[model samples]
Target: MDPTDTAVMIENYEAFRSEISLSKEDVIRELFRQNQDRISIKKEATAVRNLIRIIDSTLRLANSKGFHAMTLRDLCADSGLSMGGLYAYIRNKDDLIHLIQNHGFIITRRTLLHYTRDVPDVRDRLYAAIKAHLYLSELMRAWFYFSYMEAKSLPPQEKRDAVAIEREIEAIFLGVIEAGIDAGVYQPRNARLVSSMIKALLQDWYLKRRKYLDQNVPVDDYAMFVRDVVESYLLQA
Candidate 1:
């Protein structure tokens, strides 16, 4: 995008943030639905409510006490599910890790693509990308926080896929930058590097959320800050 061809401030997050795009209950149900074949106790464990209970408990525990250190017993206790019930959904911690990662990827990738696809202006698309990511992270705080904090704790193959998930995420932004460049709207630069930089800035929202929360900074405010900084940098000659 030619930075000069498009210069717009993003004032509305509704275009990027939607309540109906995906729901928590749907996410929980999807997890159980997709992995039911792998789950041995699937027949008796088809309750969406119970499945959600397990997922909620797992993420809460993982966020509080590191995904690596949290035990099945601990998850059961926090989630109010018996160890037997827990085993029905997951074979072990690694499976739990993959499950949470799955939730994060499904919601984030879908939301990002859904919101940005309709935006024609590279500036708006870039702006929507930044805001969409931040809002999604804000909405999926537990999963996003847990995913960022414990990505390395994942087992070998899951860890690699996790990293690739992050890259694909950044590629969403990279695609926008390349689009801008192709259209002669954005000033030329290393689009990949710029995309990574944007990812870094957006990641700070969830990584350092407490700092922003302590200062009473809202998601929209931070999104605007990052969007402005990124647009200015890209617009620079």
Candidate 2:
């Protein structure tokens, strides 16, 4: 990735983390210690839910094209909401951008968490992680593509926040690689660089999948090819 692209990824990662942290804090404040009344808590929860739906729908659509190309009408049509209804949730396109970027990271992190549970062996864990990543891209192909392409259009602050979330996800991959090395299942290399390559492979599935499918490639077969490549390049002798 170029410097600008790298910066955006890091911002996405940070935004994701910050949103999670805020959400947790809000829940605790409202429910745990009863910092807020029941009515207020419920209202806040409802608002968050609506906002999430909008962001999720928007990200799913935006990834298929350049962010600049997506308009309010596009968002309205994709989300099945009126223009006024959309504005009630967000002030403008910039706010929508922040929401979509943050939502993408949050959804991705949740998916990874679910996929990583109860797997003890490092190699299996890494394989499972790659599988989960690929499966998610398949499932949320539109959102994945939208976040990758439209993230640059976000405001400076939001852009930085989004990059942070992206970096966090990358770090998770790097950690898996490092764990495999320590467990003697993989060879030592630059974990960051290898992680990037692995991510690229996964991203290419959504970004350039038509070519692969045009060649009559099945998802399982493609995943196996990726698994084999990682094994051949990174496995210990």
The top-ranked prediction according to lDDT is 1
Clash counts for the predictions, in order: 9, 24
Give the Å shift of residue 124 in candidate 2. Answer: 0.7
TM-scores across all candidates? 0.87, 0.73
| lDDT agreement with native, every candidate | 0.77, 0.65
Query: Runs in model 2 with CA error above 4 Å?
Result: 1-53, 56-66
Q: Model 1, 1-237: lDDT tens per residue?
A: 112233333355564345534366676666677777767655533656777777788888878887778888988888888888777777888788777788777667766776677577889898888877888777777888887777666789878988888989899999999999999888998999999999998888888988998999878788889988988888887
- Quote model 1's TM-score: 0.87
TM-score of 2: 0.73
Off by over 4 Å in 1: 1-22, 41-45
Superposed by TM-score, candidate 1 places the C-alpha of residue 141 at a distance from the truth, in angstroms, of 1.9
Q: List, residue by residue over 51-118, the lDDT tens digit for candidate 2.
A: 55576566655655556777888888887778877766566777666556555565577656555545
